[model samples]
Target: MTNKLKLYFKAAQSAKIGIWEINLETNLIYWDSVTRCIHEVSEEFIPTTKNTIDFYSIDKNRDEIELLIERAIVEGTPFNKTFQITTAKNNIKYVEGICQIEFLNKKPIRLLGTFQDITKEQNLINELQQSVEKFSSIFSSANDAIFIIDISNGIITNCNPRASELTEYDNSELVGIHNSELFPVKYRKEVRVFLKSHLTKDNYIVNETYIKTKSGLTIPVEVASGKKFKVGDQTFSVCFFRDISERRNVEENMNMLSLAASETTDTIVIANPKGKAVWANNAYLKLTGFNLQEILGEKAGYLSKGPETDKRTTDKIRKAIQDKQSIKVTILNYNKQKEKYWFELNITPIFDNNNNCINFVGVGRDVTARKEKEFELRGLLEVTSHQNNKLFNFAHIVSHNIRSHASNLSMVVDVIENTENTAEKLSYFELFKEGTEKLSETIEYLNEIITIQKNTNIEKKEIRLKDEIEKTKYALSLSIKESQISIIDTIPEDLTVCVIPAYLDSILLNLFTNAIKYRHPERKAILKIGYEIDESYTIITFKDNGLGIDLEKNGHKIFGMYKTFHGNDDARGIGLFITKNQLEAMDGKIEVESKVGMGSIFKIYLNEK
Candidate 1:
């Protein structure tokens, strides 16, 4: 009874209608509380087999119930059925009866059964069936060709209406065809291998290949295929095919344009409508001294513009791009090393069929050499004019100086010829000889100047400044001692600079002589030699504490030939002039700083290694 009650409770949770038991041998019967409740009987009411059979409708329902019970009891078979029954209140209710027989010694002895209400379960099953039918309808109506293939045999098991339309075949004709028949002959084997390899794995694989239509025309397609599921012994894959002929055509045109741009000498850059670089070729990278990684996705102008860039040209370029017009301009551009170059740029806006700008293409050629040549020509013209004036003045000065010496000799000759006393005649003869010697010296100085001016080729070699300074000091030792001068050399022992050795020696010798010649009368002179170097030039400085010249009065004339500021007869005013010429011939320069009584400093700049 406890087990029977547990069974009744389990069935009640699932909306079971009733539970019953019958003894076949003695014709005894039992009914659980659920069976009594289904009949609407009182708790204490006794039940009999006759009244229970009478509860069912007195028609085919009653006969069926009697037959199902007899089959269970006599044949030991289980039976389950649902029928309408009238309760004690005369209300009809649908209830299920399930019966199983128990046998003792191979003969049926008792039967037990359970009845459950399945109305809700039946309603859910009906709704699910309807949803499946709706999903099938939608799948067939899709626009793109869809093919469902059996993975193992590569056969097309099913396909939608669009598949037939795309392949130009009837739906019934495409159903049993192998999937390989859809692909072009060249790719059929590859398609077969792909399907077989990936059929077991749950993955979506896509490929762009050709497909053959019904009329034997090949069409390019992009197919997305993957394993959909496995049912029983068959594995299935669903593939979606899209036409890509238009995309292929666009790619071909792009390839042709790229080829043309690459073969040209000029650098070509392609920018989007917003003026940002999207692509550049090898020529572009080579021209700008930059790599693709450095320039891509950057503003087109940023790669080549700097502080020296012309703002007017940049504004013009911006306006031209905004107006979708072509522009040609020559602009100064800087490379990675910050070296400037002139570039001639031609930018043209590319438009689509609708007349809307899609991109801006620029072609640039480096024109630095041509621009430099133009400037060089203008500079040469100015230099030629200055040189002509200098030559005219030089010739006049030479003539005047020679004529003055000639006139002196003439006066001396007259004196010697007219005089009667022997001693007086001898003095006049001596005067004549001195004038001739002065004239010869002047001619020699003029020849030396011409030689310096004409000789432009000077071979340069590394010379140690400290060694040269010591050598100059030794060469001028006698003069230095006579003037009572002190020498201090502060140049490094290894401080070497590239210069013409003879020119360097001559320059230093002149500086030493000048320092000694112009020594202060009150104190002994002090000469200091030092060397310094900067990025492009090596500087050697010669400083002296002596009777320094007044730079404000004679600075410009200090290096001029035959220009003298001193009252001494030995001051020929030629040493500094020759020194300046030597410095210039060796591609060097000299600067002087001097005060009236303090000292003079001459800085000689030479090209650094």
Candidate 2:
């Protein structure tokens, strides 16, 4: 071989691209350097027709390449192909081969071809194609409806199976149709305006709109639209739509049910899980004297009087909402007018699809009239019991007073009849006269109780609470000092209570004496007087750090006649009962809370005038 040919061969071997030539007349072939290397042949190996054919891939590839080569040589055709080739090393490689027939005067002379390895490039292209196919499949198979629309005409160009099913139309029927056709006539114009705004603004938006189906039924639909670029010069809009008809129907049904419940005398309110009112029915508005718009978004406790309402009832409501359960409670509620009323509230927690608490629904009914009847019955029973107790006590007093006087008279008369001395008779008669006077005083005391029952109304006037406390303290200075008591006046100077002067003085005097008499021996007594003014009433709290009474055991009889907690000889037991009656006569009330060792607090609620 010449030096130039040897250099060409060396260069071709380094290039790794196969080079070949074929004689058109004899159908003989030749392979240079890399071609021989591809066949795994030694430099000295002879190039032959059979060996070259063995390098072509087996089966169809080999036959296909052979036919192309024959056509290039016989018909002066040019051929280019990429095919798999198996080498002697048992390795497969992808190769691209191109051949052109050299022609002179329309007759073929020889064929020239080149082969290059394209395995890596072809494999990369195949992988990328597979990834695209996978993504396309997922997009088309998703449950949510998807659509591609023409922005200019609002025509639906493409849609997935879900979209077709949702609209009740096949792809052939829906394609090329105006998007406005899917909306009801009333909403079609609105939909057009929305689309125009979205397209003009080039902004993505999520919205809910009504869609009319092929069956002529309107349904709620949620749509998300964005701009997507196509290969064309103009941009196309892509919109994703989902049928939310079922969800909307459920919500409407719930609202209807709530309205139905509210129409009855029962009040109904729906609140979010945080206990904020979301919806208040008409009945609830009427019962609370608050409009739905005013109460919505406010806390559920906004209608409650914090001091009068039972804290445990509020706590139970919170717990039920947190635990996603139902709770029923009877609680005191105040209306917009600040009038106190009682209600039986049934609260139920509403849950979402995931079993999480989403909201709370409360159904309530006013039990104020029923509670008032109960209170009246209780008052009647108390009055009857008091009357029975008064009668029994009166019997003892009558026997003690009347019998003593009568017996004295009888003894004096007998002494006068049997005695000879006038002076002894006159002394006995004076004693009998004194006994008659005592009897008259006892009869007057009984008449006082009857007068209280018949006429309880008393004129009221505004009296300063602090001044009343100070006056009572001054009046009982000696008793207060003897008890070693400390008085803390937390009541505001301007705080005033409405009561008659005489009744107020009597009430204060009775409470002061009781406090001093029951002062705990182990510690100095501390009395706290405070007052709070509410919208409709003034509450005065008189708390004493003294020996407290057992409320549970003695609360029923605490304000009854002849009921006494302390065993003091001076405790007439009628003081508290009379004080309570006096306060009641002026349309006021008293409530007490106490612990055996902690202390006792008495709250007086009087109407604000």
Candidate 3:
């Protein structure tokens, strides 16, 4: 081939175009290497007129191209057209065909054309058309009022049908109006500022404002201004407007309710479903003496608890909140001043549309005076019960001790009378003196117990448990050392218990002395002291490796007045009884485990159950 022919071939290849020719007179066809490659056929394969037409993917394309080629051959016409062709590999492609008829002596001799692959260009054009159609559909059918604005002039260049409905204006009238005209007079300036700030941004800007309709009514609206872009040298912004009048009305109602709550004297608190406080009314803030910052994010009922708050009441409130239920409780609470108050509270759960707990509302009022009166009456009742118990003990002592003393005196007098001896009579007087002295001591002990039990208004003071234990150990240092006993103090240093100080001291002294007095003779004594705390009580254990009581026989009588298990001469048997009574007086409890030879374990409940 000449250099010129090679240059033309190179140009066609660069353009992705192939050359083809057909001899009309001979009905033969020629395909260049590029054309053969386009058909996905081997270079050695030759094509003919009949076989070439088979490459047309559809009958319409085959007939259209055939007509074009016939017209070109018969009338010496030229044509350019785009059609689909299936290659030898059965793959479809769009190709542009340009053909020109070559003439010999005014009769058509051949047909030549360039076939260019236009598949990529056709695909791009189809995609662009689809995007435009989708955008048009959304713009015309959207629920929100849509508007296109000319950014340079703030004019409403175009708007959806919904915009006309929202403004109660004709479409023709709305297209030329200033964008700010849609907003009320009071909000137009602000809307303009929002629009200016938004149009330069890369994202949509949202805000709340009021719009003025053609009917002269102002309605609340939430608007979002879409990003701005240039179209045909004019920068435009698309904006959405939504009617929010109903939402505004709901918000206004909520504000009115809030105002009412803030003014009420009853305490009101609002918390999340998790029990964390979100808001508290003025009365609640005054009652707790906590600022918003101090309580926000904290559990609603937690801040007012103190040394005297009943754990049962608090637990009831907590479980109610966790279960998404409502509860009513009258509980004692302490303010920031550590001053006591009684609150009658009602907590209700707020649920969402899905039946899920979204918030909790608590309302309460101070009932301190009524509560104080009730406590006084309850205290009196408790005192009377203790007095009755004391009277029962007194009666038992009288029946058991006084009768024995009376019978012994009678026997002694009889002895004196029968003997008729002055020395014998004088000795009998000594026995009388001993009997009367024993009765007097019993009366004194009973009087002491009566006084202790009658003080029903015993104030419980918070005391560090480990410190009190150490103090008791120090007071009994000599006895502990003499007993040669091992002491294991395992109570945590920071543990605290609230109880009457004197009662606590007495109970500790009794337990310690009792342990030392009953030490086993055959083995070294070991006392392990430790404690465990639960939701409402602290259990302290005193485990002793010593002579254990026979619980099977003496268990019922262990804590009874004047009851003794072992035959120790000095065992008055009142220590355990007094210990039990002291614990009861302070709303505490005690339990014991013992065996004949193993050891003893005493578990004392330091706080109320």
Candidate 4:
């Protein structure tokens, strides 16, 4: 071979192109050094036509190359094709085969071709195709609006489906349109300037702007833009935008609700169904004298109930909340200063769409003054009812006692008129006189009762209960001596009770007289008097070992007028009644305990004036 020809052949081999030939007559193949290297065979190895064909892929590759060679030989035509082959070492590669047939006398004998390794080029093409497919997938499925723009002209090259959706435009209409078409008129100039500055830096840039939809409605949006890449002389950028109208609206509504809650005057609390407070408004803090930090996650009732709070009302509130029902109650509560107050509380159960109790809303108003007024009104009503009953009893006494006395006097006077004997007439006149005297006594008793019912200003004075007992014992000394009663005064000398002087004297005198009058016939009468102070009240007690009355049968009537028990000869049932009236008139109370045979105790509670 010539040197230049050898140099040319060496250059082709350096380029990784291998020359191959087949001799039809010998049915053999010839391969250059490059060909043997390409096949990964031994350097000195000679190959047969069949083995050389096996170097191609098993089925389609081998058959196609063989048919191409046959056509080049038989038709005397040249052909070039790219096909795959598996080398002797099991490495698969793509190679281009260009074949030509050499003929003598127009009869085909030899085929020649060159095999070039095109594996790297084919791999790069495959990688580019995969990258395109990945880009296509992401562009179509992104949630945010995406745009590909030519930075030089501000023209849109492509837009994703989401971009079209946000702009209310079709995908076909969006492509090839200027980016300014999507921007509001006022923002178009700013957007252009922003794009220009950002393209130079090629760094990510985020800006907020308003966009005009296809229907011309302006919507706020956030744009995240950056230069994605450069292709040849063209610089491309990508922008992602999302509409922020809904998020802004939510923030605005939340601000308004927070403002209202902070400024409302009613005490409000939001709590879980377990009664733990989740939120408390400013009014709640003022009402309860506690801050939100102190009460949060604590039981709502912790601040609402104190020593004087009604337990029954608290239990009802809890049950109502647990059952997801609304309840309204007025209960006494205390503040940080430990002052008593009343509140009208309204608790409403808050439920979700699933009908599950999620929380409770409690609203409270201060009703302390109103409650106090109601208490006073109730006391007045009770006093009026008591007075009415007393008046009715007075009428009954007038109709029964006074009429009987008057009828007796008229009958006696008629007898006096019909009698002829002076003794009988004088006896009738005496009967008339006795009936008038009894009538006068009844009238005087009625007058005393009427006086007791009137709201007179009785002056109160600090008087020793023991001194009062001594005075009463002196006044009833004759009765006491006649009954041979024993008096025992256990009252403390220093203990003083506030009472009207006359009422106190009358009360003690009546008690001593009753004890002597009702003395047991079997035992000597003994009276024990005692006094003590309990909180704001001074208690005076009179206990006597006497003919005890049965309280079970006559307890309600013990203090009633004209009501008698034990059928005692001197039992007018008026002294005890009058005694009760005087004590109550001085804003004091009287109670009694007695048994048929065991004796009786009368207890009086007087205020400390």
Clashing pairs in 1: none
TM-score-best of 1 and 2: 2
Candidate 4 C-alpha error for residue 290, in Å:
17
lDDT tens digits, residue span 1-609, model 2: 799966865676677778788886786778876776766677776666677778776789889888997787677789899888887787787788888778878988988877778879888888999998996896699777888887666788888888788889998888889888888899888777787888778878888888888898788998888866665765678787888876787588777987687667788888888889988777778888888778888887576654689888888877877777898998999988888889899988877678877678898989999999999999888777655544544454444334534544565567678988888777666655654554464467446544543432334678787887886675455457667888887877787777755456656766776677787888889988877888877887889988899988999999998888878885667767766765665567789898887678888778766
Return the clash pairs for model 3, or none.
none
- lDDT computed for candidate 1: 0.77
Error of 2 at 423 (Å): 31
**CA deviation > 4 Å runs, candidate 2:** 1-144, 152-161, 169-190, 204-209, 212-218, 226-234, 247-266, 272-275, 322-326, 348-361, 379-609
Candidate 3 lDDT, tens digit per residue, 290-390? Answer: 88888999998788999989999999999999999999999999888889899999999987567988678899999999988998999888778876755
Could you tell me every candidate's TM-score relative to the true structure? 0.36, 0.40, 0.48, 0.44
* N/CA/C clash count, model 3: 0
Top model number, lDDT:
3
RMSD of 2: 16.2
User: Candidate 1 versus the native: TM-score?
Assistant: 0.36
In model 2, how large is the Cα lDDT of residue 4?
Answer: 96
| Per-residue lDDT over 100-213 for candidate 1, one digit per residue giving the tens place of the 0 to 100 score | 878889888999877554445655666898898886887688867898888777778888888887888898988888888888888988776776666656688887888898
The residue-by-residue lDDT of candidate 4 on 165-276, one tens digit each, is 8999998999899999898888999988887778778789998888999999999999988756889998789999889886577457546755878788888888887889
Rank order (by lDDT, best first): 3, 4, 1, 2
Q: Can you give the lDDT of residue 209 in candidate 3?
A: 92
lDDT of 4: 0.79
Whole-model lDDT, model 3: 0.82
Off by over 4 Å in 4: 1-5, 58-60, 260-609
